[model samples]
Target: MLSKSHLKALSFIREFIVHEGYAPTLSEIALGIGIRSKGVVHRYVQALAQEGVIELHAGRKRGITLPEPNKERDMTLPLAGRIAAGRPIEAIEDQVRVDLAAFFIGPGRFALQVCGDSMEEAGILDGDMVVVAQQEHAADGDIVVALIDNEEATLKYLRRNPQGDISLIPANSAMVPMVYAAERVRIQGVVVGQLRTYGKR
Candidate 1:
């Protein structure tokens, strides 16, 4: 239900928040959409806020934040604190809402919970939820979720040999690489972001 202008504004806001950790200013929004009037930009922003695409603060200049729409639209995930501070923790009864679309890049992206330490050297720890973008193919050295022999799924660095054979290299050196013929393996997606929560499950 969003117009082209409104969608453009949302796209700009998405990119700005991803890179800057805050919303763009009115003038910045204007420049992004080629609007000559700040008033016009403000109106567009207000419209977006009304649509539940963004949350607006009344008094602050950089007050726009992506709305955490739980059952409405967009993905919501728990942000359970930091990794540095650690302990055996239990899940809290109350949860904070965070819109995962703000952090993810492409459409059709999904998350998977990492199960083992096979990719620990790559900074992917067990219990980490990896955001993966669906794809049929991948470039060299890209970490990908791959289906092996049409049965097993695994996360590893994908390397294709000149002969077209595939090597699934585990980041943890202790784990040996897995080799398979190109015909036997299917690429499901590429790892885009790794999410982890500490002090809570």
Candidate 2:
């Protein structure tokens, strides 16, 4: 069994790779896990390599790599039970599996990590990953990734006025909406789902 430190190191490496699109160096790993000793970090890496949890490439500075996930395994979780968000309810067991792949994976679907709190009221916080469906057109009130002037991109609620102006509305009440000419805004994608990690990110 892997110790707590091993798990923490593994988790950090995974997150770093997902965010940066490459493996982190030993020093980066040490910094990420709050350890001061590169020797200790090297030992942890060697242990993980011995356990077949990661691969190490000799002569490479950033050689750590996670094994590929088994594609045949179903991406699902047990439904288990349901809980109320408001009123109290009786707990009941469920026998269903929630197929995450069905909901989040499809042609033209992609995910983007949120970077700001502009959509907090809509339950999309900073650091959350939003699954988006690629499309060029969106109806009014759809939360979408909008490209402005073919340059800057932002996530907001799409709104159209009779005057042919488009408004990019933020979920936060503290912020005002941005108005643009209809021709200046391009619809990139609509948000379909979202995911967030609970603990240390």
Candidate 3:
């Protein structure tokens, strides 16, 4: 966790580096953070460096630099309003950040690359990466990754019949659902989110 002053200094340094194409000096950072003492600003900078949020280079005029952004975590994107999927609608600009970490990263969460079209009708296509929340159980209607007889694994919708039987349902109409004894099917995880890539792999 970072204090308010630390966060402010970090924000200023980031914005300054982005606009100026180089890191700011301690004096510049002091001016940006509305602080009068260089020593105080240096203490904040040292603290940020200790936290691994920024790096310092010895004997350089502009020594501070931010680390590269992580690709697999803590990513955010602008939510620039909605578009109609069925009909034409007016475009409106909206300023909002969609934090990808909140949706895909969490305790016991993992991702699996989809292999088949069993879930095509559910808008989950082959080759898509599905994020799963690992657990031993799931609701009756949840799409889940299941281990069958502890031998084969598959993705399907879970259904519990009144007779204590389980059904692994597929989204494609061309395929039939698999019925198994409740003891034969082990719920590995539940589908939480998905990712698809366009163009060359």
TM-scores of the candidates in the order shown: 0.59, 0.52, 0.53
Q: For each of the candidates, give the backbone clash count.
A: 0, 0, 0
Using TM-score, give the best candidate's number.
Answer: 1
lDDT winner between candidates 2 and 3 = 2
Question: Global lDDT of each model?
Answer: 0.75, 0.76, 0.75
- Flag the better candidate by TM-score, 1 or 2: 1
RMSD of each: 10.2, 17.4, 13.0
> Alpha-carbon error at 87 in model 2, in Å?
38
lDDT of 2 by residue, 1-201 (tens): 356898899889999999999999989999999999999999999988766678899998789888777624454444433321111123244675545554364557666666677788999887776777889999999998887787567888999999999998888888888899999988978988887889998
Candidate that scores best on lDDT: 2
What ranking emerges by TM-score with the best candidate at the front? 1, 3, 2
User: lDDT per residue, candidate 1, 1-201, as tens digits?
Assistant: 356788899999999999999889999999988888999888889888866788899899899999774747645644322221011122222354445655463456666666677788889887787777879989999998787776567788899999889988887767678889999988878888887889866
Question: In model 3, how large is the Cα lDDT of residue 171?
Answer: 86
The clash number for model 3 is 0
Worst lDDT 10-window in candidate 2: 82-91
Candidate 2: the clashing residue pairs are none
Model 3, global lDDT: 0.75
Off by over 4 Å in 1: 1-28, 31-74, 77-101
